[model samples]
Target chain A: SQTIHQWPATLVQPVGSPLSLECTVEGTSNPNLYWYRQAAGRGLQLLFYSVGIGQISSEVPQNLSASRPQDRQFILSSKKLLLSDSGFYLCAWSVLGGLETQYFGPGTRLLVL
Target chain B: AQTVTQSQPEMSVQEAETVTLSCTYDTSENNYYLFWYKQPPSRQMILVIRQEAYKQQNATENRFSVNFQKAAKSFSLKISDSQLGDTAMYFCALASGTYKYIFGTGTRLKVLA
Candidate 1:
């Protein structure tokens, strides 16, 4: 069985503060990772996706960035947070050849005050 | 680029009744995938069902099923014997050849008990 884990389930930070949200998958290797943000009462916006280590494709150019340090470890970071950056952050993983069925983590609720 | 559309912003249904959520997508690729995801309040987003473009048979999981019309570009989800747990934000997504997914605006379904 595969499981995805995310930390700091709920975060409250002031403006200009740094942000770091971690996501890791167990029981799978070389999996594709993705980062998405969902604003209140809105659809999900894909932010970044990685095929392999050190390879990240950003969908929306914003203050956030993503990094794949290991095969199953992905991190979403931001140097400075904005009020608009507050939302629900979700991390997902899928197999390389299997294009469908993306598993999601519990997610992180970030609030930038 | 592929695009997914969920016209209904919100829908309500009585418990034990049936409800169908509409989804339409636009894609030039023949071989692709369509998925329905559910996001419960204050919980993780999970996959409900998936349909492959190559397959003609619709996908079904327990009480959830999909009506996949490739020619019409419509993939609607039907929930039978709906329960209170069925209340959530439903998202329709399309993935074609790429590793990323294009998500619709989503439909908020409220199942009244």
Candidate 2:
């Protein structure tokens, strides 16, 4: 069985501070990874997705960016955090190629103050 | 471009009752996929059900099922024998032969005990 892990699970960052959220998938290789954000009382907004290592596609350009440094490791980062950047950040993985079901991690709740 | 819509913003159902959450999507592609994801209070996205466009039969997983109308572009999720643990935000998503997934705004479901 495959499992996705994310941390710190919850984060509190001050404005203009750097942000880094990590996601790693166990028992899967070459999986498609995605980054998503959900504001309070809202749905998900896809931020970035990667089909392979060093290949990242931005769905909505904003303060955040994503990188797949390793096959099973994906990281969401920002040089500076904004108040608007506070939300529930989700990391998901799917089978390689298209139209596969995505599995999500426990998620990281970032509160930018 | 593909888009998903969930008409209900919030709903409540008594325990053991059946509730249907409406979802509709727009896509020009003939072959694609639709998915329903559940986000509990923990904000972990759990895949509830999925439907492939090529399959004629609607997909069902235990107490969860989907009404997939390809022509109507409607894909609704039905939760039978709802439980208190079913209280969460349900999101409808569409993947059209790409890495991109468009998600609905989400419907908050409360299974009252």
Candidate 3:
């Protein structure tokens, strides 16, 4: 079975601080990875997605960026966090080259103060 | 461009009762996929059910099932014998063959004891 892992499960970052959230998947290779953000009581907003290493597509333009440094390893980063950047960040992975179901990680809750 | 719409922002139902959450999408492509995801209080995104555009039969998983109307562009989720554990934010999503998914704003389902 495939599983996705994300950390730090919860984060508290001061305004203007750097941000880094990591996601890794096991039991699958060359999977499609995605980053999404959800507000307090709102729908998910897609931030970025990667089909392969070094290839990323941004769904929305904002303070965040994503990178697929290795197959099955994806990272969401920001040079400086904004108050608006605080939310529940989710990482998901799906099978490659197909319309397979996406599996989500536990998620990272970032609180910016 | 593909878009998903969950008309209900919030819904409530008595435990053991059945509740249907409505969802509709817009897409120009004939071959695609639709999915329903549940975000529990634990904040983990769990795949509840999935429907392929090419298939006429609806998708079902245990107590959860989807009413997929391709011509109507509607894919509503019905939860039978709802439980408190079923309380969560349910999101509808559309994915084309290109591997890109567009999510609906989501509906908050509250199952009262």
Candidate 4:
């Protein structure tokens, strides 16, 4: 079975601080990883997606960035966080083609104060 | 580029009753995919059902089913015998070769006793 894991289930950080959220998938290789943010428990805004290591695509221009350092490891980072950056971050994975079922991680809730 | 639209912002139904959430999409690609995802209070995103553009039969999973009309570009989710557990934020997503997903704003559904 495939499992996606995300860390710092809940986070509270002051403004201007650095942000780092990690996501990893087990039981699958060369999966398409994605980063999404949900604000106020509403819609999801896709942040980044990677088809392979060192490849990243951003859907929205904002204070966040993503990197795929390994085949199954994806990281979302920011040098300086903004108040608008506070939201629930989710990691997802799909097969190579990207047009397939997506499995989601537990997610990380970040509160920037 | 593709766009998904969920017309209902919020809806409530009496437990054991039925409810339908509307979703429509716009796409030029011949091969694409559609998905209905549920975000419960726990905040975990779960895939409820999926439909393929090439398939003529609508997809169904237990109590959840989709009314997929490709020509109409409508994919509505119907929940039968709704239960309290059905309360959640529902998202409709469209995906294709781009390796990216265009998600709808979402429809919040609440099952009342």
Each candidate: RMSD: 1.0, 1.0, 1.2, 1.1
Name the regions of candidate 2 deviating beyond 4 angstroms: none
- Pick by TM-score: 2 or 4, better one: 2
TM-score of each: 0.97, 0.97, 0.96, 0.97
Model 1 over residues B26-64: C-alpha lDDT tens digits?
999988999999999976889999999999999999999
True contacts kept of each: 0.77, 0.97, 0.87, 0.74
Between which residue pairs do clashes occur in model 1? none
Tens-digit per-residue lDDT, B3-111, candidate 4 = 8999899999999999999999999999999999999988989999999999999999999999999999999999999999999999999987678888899999999
Worst 10 residues of 4 chain A by lDDT: A38-47
* Residue lDDT tens for model 2, B20-95: 9999999999889999999888889999999999999999999999999988999999999999999999999999
Per-model C-alpha lDDT, please?
Answer: 0.93, 0.93, 0.93, 0.93
Ranking by DockQ: 2, 3, 4, 1
- For model 4, the docking class works out as medium
Q: Compared with the true structure, what per-residue lDDT tens digits does model 2 show for residues A55-86?
A: 99998878888888899999999999999999
Per-model DockQ against the true two-chain complex: 0.75, 0.90, 0.79, 0.76
Global CA lDDT computed for model 3 = 0.93
The structural similarity of chain B in model 1 to the true chain B, as TM-score, is 0.98
> Which of candidates 1 and 4 reaches a greater DockQ?
4
Q: What is the lDDT of residue A38 in candidate 4?
A: 90
Q: Which 10 consecutive residues of model 2 chain A have the lowest summed lDDT?
A: A59-68
